[model samples]
Target: MKKTESISFQDFMNESYKKVKRRSRPYRTFSFVPFSPFAMLDPTILTIGGIVLGVVLIERFLERLGVLDIVDKISSVMRFLFPLTFFGAIIYFLVTF
Candidate 1:
């Protein structure tokens, strides 16, 4: 049988550290969006909804100020209709209550 060489503690630690560094994977980042009404809902869906709402509001504001021109009439109409429908639903709910 061949005699095995023993590794010094410092050398063993360095080798282990190097192996760990080589095997390390990149960390993943996640965005958190806080929605009070939907606390029980999935965080990913909440984040996506918040992002979409922010984009829609920004685009509508820019369009209103003539800073952004939307080429699609259907998109423009849908944007306008969404807010109106939302407010109308709120009013209807309030009136029913």
Candidate 2:
């Protein structure tokens, strides 16, 4: 049986760099699509936008989960605030009456 050895990281990096160098050379002409000035026309831009949107969505999900986790804490803290709120309401009622 014959066994093959894996290429070293330096050799892999050299080949990858060569491929990137070839692809990165500029061509003679570049065509552009016409679109609304403010709108992004690149698919990569849309993908980036989608990623940002996903991050925001995940952040909101985490925020809601945190709020759910802290609901009992909120109620305990509101015990003190409620008295002040009630006092204000009673004073308002008396002044209005």
Candidate 3:
């Protein structure tokens, strides 16, 4: 008498495992930190760098909106409210967390 071929649990799992791997092979490194203090410098340097970056970003945004020349006027007004914004953020974080 001839013996019939049998499918074991291990064989079934191996085939399914290969299909899962193939399907998920496209997504590799998901979490990424492009900018971090550890990669760059001390607090003082970071603070100054952040200020410069902020100025550049604001300038770019204003230029895009054709308001680049109004930055100085905007800054004078925004300087006062900057503290309020910080205080509000702190209060929000404390209340939520």
Candidate 4:
């Protein structure tokens, strides 16, 4: 009769997994200002626009998961609303200031 040895899950994984090698190059940091034509936009308008964008994104995700429908109509509205709201915010800020 022959005896067999069983390997534990942790031991099997350790043996099968390969460690990634670290890069030898030194890290460098760079800084630059992002182009923001809306930098002067009103805070309130920006906040509202952000909220709308967030809702649209969440709804789209739900639609993908089959948890919700009506995204087609919502997306159509959002297509027009998104740029309008944000750009309106910037315009309003510029005009008011």
Candidate 3 lDDT trough over 10 residues, lowest sum: 16-25
Clashes counted in candidate 3 amount to 0
List the pairs of residues colliding in candidate 1: none
Weakest ten-residue segment in model 2 by summed lDDT: 33-42
lDDT for every model? 0.61, 0.57, 0.62, 0.74
Model 2, range 1-97, lDDT digits (tens) per residue?
8987577799787775344333567668745743444444445455655755665565567567886555555556556765665565546544543
TM-score of each: 0.31, 0.30, 0.33, 0.46
Task: Report the number of the highest-TM-score candidate.
Answer: 4
Clashes of 1: 0
Ranking by lDDT: 4, 3, 1, 2
What does candidate 3's lDDT look like per residue over 1-97, in tens digits? Answer: 9987667789787775344333545655654654444543545445655765686588668868888568767677667856666576546544543
Full-model lDDT, candidate 3: 0.62
Cα misplacement distance, residue 49 of candidate 3 (Å): 16
Candidate 4 regions off by >4 Å?
Answer: 1-42
